[model samples]
Target: MKILITNDDGIYSPGIAALAKIAAAFGEVRIVAPDVEQSSMGHAITHSRPLSLKKSPIAFDGKEAYRVNGTPADCVALGLHIYPDTEVVLSGINMGPNLGNSMWHSGTLAAAKQAVLLGITGIALSTPVGKTEPDFNAFADYVKEALEVIFENKKLGLYNVNFPPQPKGLRWTRQSVRLYDGKVVPALDPMARKHYWITVTPLEQAEEGTDRWAVEHDFVSITPLRLDLTNEDELKKQLDSAVELNKQL
Candidate 1:
């Protein structure tokens, strides 16, 4: 199995390095990631500008690695083009949590989504960060276990995985249909110039089997996701309403 590993965090980040080590045990691992952090960049591609891919010799335990000057999705796109026979695409070991609706804007998850769009199974792994530094070596075994399970079920399409700061076990979860309290705060710099900062505070509510609920309860949450966003019930309702309107006319 040829595996392509990537992350929203830069190629130099400890998170990617840790992920690469785990991936190396599986197959021929290729690490192609953003040269700089592209966190919360969504499922964006690099169609506007030419992408720059610089090969780094002996990077990530001597696995073939490259640094890309683009978003996480861009890295996956180029990685696939270069290594077309790649079986799996693994993104992150991200610096933060990508749970609930936050997955919509997470570059970590975006890389994985890109792979699925290209007709490959994609698995995105992330861990929450806090005041205490994460001991990745301690959780390496757990990550390997998670990857093995994902690999065993390759036809599952795209998956969004988020590990707790202190993970106890894994759970099959669903995406939370919850909203965050978003705000834009204006601040003044030293020069007294005003600038705005956009922020979102998550309202962590546990509803049994949701991704946020599992993560909040100290479990590794795995949510199988799909590219289709159709509202079948709504579509059926609208079709019925149209028929009624046509009869009236």
Candidate 2:
């Protein structure tokens, strides 16, 4: 299997290096990522300007690695073009977790999503961070296990995976859908210039069997995902209404 590894945390991030090392066991692994951090960039593509790929300044376990001057999605686009036979695209081992609704704007997940959009299997893996950097060596085995679980199921074209610092086991999970309180806090810099910071807080507790709950309970969470955003139930209701209106006319 040919695997393309990437991340939103930039080319120099230890998370990507760690992932590349483990993924080498699976297949031929190549690293292509942003030259600088592109966290929370979502599934954005950079069409306005020409993008460039350069040899990584740092080595990734001696893997062939390149850095791109674009978003996480752009890296995947260019990487797949360069290696058209890539079978799987693994994004992250991100610096932070991408659980729950945060997937909406997560560049880590975006890289994986891009792969799935281009008709390949894509998986995004992440873990929570604390005051210090995560000891990735401690969770190396779990990373391998996560890959095994994802690969065994060929039907799963896309997945969002999250691991607790020390996972007891793995669990199949669904995306956590809950309400949140979005906030914009104003602040002043040392120069007394006003600035604003946007953040969010969850309003409800995580539901059981969800990605958030699985990770909270110290299990690796793997949530299968799809590209479609359509609400089938709502579509059916709208179609039924249209039929009734047509009959009345």
Best by lDDT: 2
Model 2 earns a TM-score of: 0.97
**Distance from true position, residue 219, model 1, in Å?**
0.6
TM-score of each: 0.94, 0.97
Candidate 2, which segments miss by more than 4 Å at Cα?
none
Best by TM-score: 2
Candidate 1: residue 220 lDDT (0-100): 86
lDDT of 1 by residue, 10-102 (tens): 898888889888888898989999999999999988787798899864367778899999999999999999999999999988989898888
lDDT of 1 at 61: 73
Score each candidate by Cα lDDT: 0.89, 0.94
Model 2, range 97-166, lDDT digits (tens) per residue? 9989999999999999999989889999999999999989988999999999889877649999998999
Error of 1 at 130 (Å): 1.5
